[model samples]
Target: MELIEVADAVQLGVERMGVGPPVLLIGGLGMPSQIWELSGLTAALVDAGFSVIAYNTRGVAPSTATEPPYSVDKLASDAEHLLEACGITEALVVGYSLGCYTAQCLVRRRPDMVTGAVFLAGLQPSPIGALVGQMELDLIGRLGEIPAQVRVFEQLMTTLSPAMLQDPETVSIWRQLLADGDSLWSDRKGLHGQLAASFEWIMNEEPHPEHLAQISAPVLVLAFEHDVFFPPRTSRETAQQIPNSQFKQIDGAAHGGLFSNETNVVETIAQFCADQRHRLDGGGSRYASP
Candidate 1:
C-alpha cells in the first residue's frame, strides 16, 4: 500500500496490485481496502489479469479525510482525481454500496473518464430507501467509535447468507476479524462524515430514474438476490432506467454476500472487465451504446 497525493490535496492510502488492465475498486461505508485484502478479491482479480487499485476512502487514515460539507459528488471528484494522479487515463470502476454512488457521479459528471462501471449492492433514491437511510444515520450517530465498529461488524454478519454462517470455519474467520476491534473503522469524525455524506447522496444527489440517461459509459448493475440494504428489485429497476445497461442479480449473495460468496462476484466482474478491455482495444464496444 502506498500513500499517493492527488490533485485534491489529500493523500490517499492506495494499493495498486498485479500487472494488467487497471480496475478501480471503490469501497463503501465501513469498508476500506484492507477488507478487500481480507476477502481475497484483489488476488483473485490479479490472477485474472487485472491490476486492482484498492484504496481506503476518506476517514480511513493514512488516507486523510476532507473537511466538513461532504457530498458524494465531492467524493466522486476525489476518485477521478486519484486516477489522474496515478496516470491511468481510463479504467473499469467497480463500486459497492456508497462506492457505487461515487461511481455514478463519475460516469455522469465525466463520462470519458471511465471505460466501464459495475455497481454492486447499490441503493437508489426512493421513499422507502430514504427512511432506511434515516434509521441508519440515527443508529450511527448514537454509537461511538468502538461501538460503531461493533455495530458494523454485526451488520456485516447479517449480510452473509445463513448457510455460509452455518459453516464453523466461516464464522471463525469473521469472528476473528471482528475481534480485532478499532482497526476495522477509521477516525470517528471521518466515520460520521462518511455516513452523513452517504445519506445526503442517497436522499438528494441520487438522480431520478429518468436522470440516469445522462450516463454514457457501459454499465453493469449487480444486485445480491437478498440484499435488503439495496433490494434486487430496485437495483434492477434502476438498471432499466439507464439506457442499454446490463443488470444481473446473483442468486446466493446478500448485501455483504459478495465477499462471503466471493467466487461468483470476483469471477463475474473479472469477465466483464476482460470483455470491456477487449472491446476498447479493438475499437469496438461490446456493451450496447446509450
Candidate 2:
C-alpha cells in the first residue's frame, strides 16, 4: 500500500502487485480499492503475469476528499496524474461501473497513456440508473441523511441479482458483509460526491455517447448477464461505437459479478490482456482520436 499524490495535494490510497505489464484497476462508485483483493482478482492477475495497480477514489478513506458534486472528468484527471506519478507510460486500463466513465474520459483525453481498456459491467448508459441517481440525490436533499443500515440494504438489493438474493446461503453471506458495512456508506460527503458523479455519468455529461467513437485504444466491453444497470444490449451498442472494441457477457451474473464470479472475471480479463499484448507485439498501430 502507498499514498500517491495527484492534483490539489490530495493523496490517493494505491496498491500494486506483480511486476509484469501494467494494468490499472479502477473500481465502481464509492467502491473500495480492497474489493480487488477481496474478490481475488488482484492475486489472480499477478499469477497471470501482469502488474496490477488499484486505488481508492478520492473521498474514500485514506484518500482526501474535496467538495461534493464531483464530475467524472475530475475523477479521470486524478487517474491520469496517478499514472504520471507512477511513471507508467502505458497500461491496460480496467474500469468497473462508474470507473468505466473515468476510463472512457482518460482514454479520450490521453490516448498515449493507455494501451487498451476494459469496461467491466458498465460503460453503457442506463435510463433506470439515471432515475435512481436523481431519486437518491433528492432523498439526500430532503432527508438530510439516510441511515447507514438502510443504505447498505439498498445497495445489496440493487447490486446483487435476484437469483443471488434468493439463495439462502448467498443471502446469509451478504448479511455478514452488510453487517461489516462499507466506509463509503458512512462518509456523507464522499457518498454524496460519488452519487453526483454517477448521476452525471449516466446523464452523459462527461464522455457522451458520441465520444465513444473518439476512443483510439482497443476496448473490451464486459457485461454481466443479469446486469440491470448496463444490460448486454446497451453494452453491445457501446462496443459497436468504439473503433476497436469487443463485447462479451458473463453468464449468471449481475452488476455485483465482480464478487460473485471473481474467478471467471479474472480469467476473462487475463485473456483480454494477453491478446492485447500479442496485438501490440505484432506491431499493431492504434488510431489517433479525431
Candidate 3:
C-alpha cells in the first residue's frame, strides 16, 4: 500500500497488484478500501491477469479527509490526481455506489483518460433526492451524539441489506469504519458541511444521463437482483441511457452480495473485459444487451 497526495492534501492510499490492462477499483460511500481486502475480490482480480488498483476515498481510512467541504467533483479530481500519480494515463474504471458518481464525474471531466467503465450497484442522480427525502433531518440533528449515531448507522446498514447483519466480517469492518469516522461525525459543523456537499452534488448537478450519449467507451452496468438501495430497474435505466452499454443482473444477490458472491462477479467482469478486448481485435460485438 502506498499513499499518494492529491488535491487538498488528501493522502489517498492505493494498492496495486498484477500486470496488464489497468483496472481502477473505487469503493462505495463510508466504506474503506479495506473491505475489498476482506472480500478477496482484489486478489481474485489480480489473479485473473489484470492489473488492479484500489484506493481509499477521501474521508475514508488511509485517505486524508478534505477540509470541512468535499463534493463529488472534488472526489473525481482527487481520482484524476491519484491516477496521474500512479502513471496511469488511461484505465478501465470500476466504481460502486457513491464511487460510481465519482466515476461519472471523472469520465465527464476527462474522457480522454478513460478507456471503459463498469458501474456496480450504481444509481441515477435523482436517487439521492429520494434518499434525502427518506432521511429525517430531525434524526440527523440528534446524530450529534456519537453513541446514538453509531447505533443508528449500524441499524441503517442492516436495514439496507439484511446480509450485512448476518455477515460478521462485514459488520465488523463497518463498525471499525464508524469508529474511525466518529470524530468527523460528532463534529456537527463538519458533518453538516459534508452532508451539504453531498446533497449539492447529487441534487444540483445534472445526472450522468445527459452525458451517457457522450460516452463512446463501452460500459457494463452490473446490478444485483435484490439490491435494496438500487433496484434492478435502476441498472436497466442506466444502460439504456448509454449509447454503448450493456446491463446484467446477477441472481440471488443483494447490494453487497457482489462482494460476498465474488466468483460470479469476477467471472462476469472477466468475460465482459475479454469480450471487449476481442471486439477491439476485430471481433464483432457478440454479447447481447440485457
Candidate 4:
C-alpha cells in the first residue's frame, strides 16, 4: 500500500499489484479496498497480466474526508488527480455501486483519461435515487447511536448472498474488523457522509445517460441476476444508452457477488478487456459512432 496525495492535500491510499495494462478498481460506499481483498479478484487480475490499483475512496480508511459536504463530482476530480499523480494517462476503470457514479462523472468530466470502463451493480437515476434516499435516511437516524448503527450494518451486510456470509474466512475477517470500536466509529461517520453525497448526486445531478453518447471509451455493464440494489434491467438500460456497449448478467450472484463470485467476475472482466484491446488494435472503433 502506498500513500499518495490528491488535490487539496487529501491523502489517498492505494495498493498497486500486478504488471500489465493499468486497471483501477474503485469500491462501493462504506467499504474500503479490503472488500476486494476478500474476493481474490485483484490477485487474479494480476495473474492475468494486468496491473491493478485498488484505492479507498475519499472518506474511507486512510483517505482524508472532506468537511461535511461532498459530491460525486468532487470524488471524480479526486480520481482524476490520483491518476495524474500516479502518471496514468489512461486506464481501464472498474467501479461498483457508488464507485460507478464516480466513474461516470470521471468520464463525463475527462473522457480523454479513460480508456475503458466497467460498471458492476451500478445504480442509475430515478428509482435508484429513491432507494438511496431511504438508505441515507436510515444512516442519519443511527448516526448518534454507535451500537445501533453497527447492528444495523451487520444485518444489512448479512442480507447479501449467503455465499458471502457463509465463507468462514470472510466472516472471521469481518468479525475481527468489527472488533475495532474506533475503526467502526470513524468509518461510520465516513459512511454516513458518503451516503449523503451519493443521495444528493443521484437526485440532483444531471442524468449520466445524457452523456453516454459523448464517451469515446469502450464500456461494459456487468450486473448480477439477483442484485438487490440495482436490478439487471438498470444495467441493460444503461448499456442501451451507450452506443455499442456490452451488457452481461451473471447468474447465481447478488449485488455483492462481484466479490463473492470471484472466478466468474475476473474471467468476465479479463475477456471483456481482451475483446476491447482486439478492437482497438484491429483499427475498428470499440464504441459505435453516435
Best by lDDT: 2
lDDT tens digits, residues 27-110, model 1? 987577877777777887788776778888877766776654467877787788888777677778998888988888888777
Candidate order by lDDT, highest to lowest?
Answer: 2, 1, 4, 3
Candidate 2 stretches greater than 4 Å from native: 205-207, 278-290
Winning model by TM-score:
2
TM-score of 1: 0.85
Q: How high is each candidate's TM-score?
A: 0.85, 0.91, 0.78, 0.82
Write candidate 4's Cα lDDT for 1-290 as tens digits.
Answer: 67789876688878877666677788887667877777776776777666777898887877887665578888898888887777776777888888988898898888877778888777454464466566555756766433545544553463356576678787666556555634632345566667776787767744466687777788888887766666787668767888757888877776667665533887787777766554333232222111
- Candidate 2: tens digits of C-alpha lDDT, residues 158-218: 6778788888998788877766555554267777888898897777544465788888888
Compose the digit string of candidate 3's lDDT tens values, residues 202-242. Answer: 66644556777898888888877767656787668867988
Which ranges of candidate 3 are over 4 A from the true structure?
125-129, 132-197, 205-208, 277-290
Q: Between the candidate structures 1 and 2, which one is better when assessed by TM-score? A: 2
Compared with the true structure, all predictions reach lDDT values of 0.73, 0.80, 0.67, 0.71
Measure candidate 4: CA RMSD: 5.5
Candidate 2 colliding pairs: none
Q: Please report the TM-score between candidate 2 and the true structure.
A: 0.91
Say what the RMSD of model 3 is: 6.3
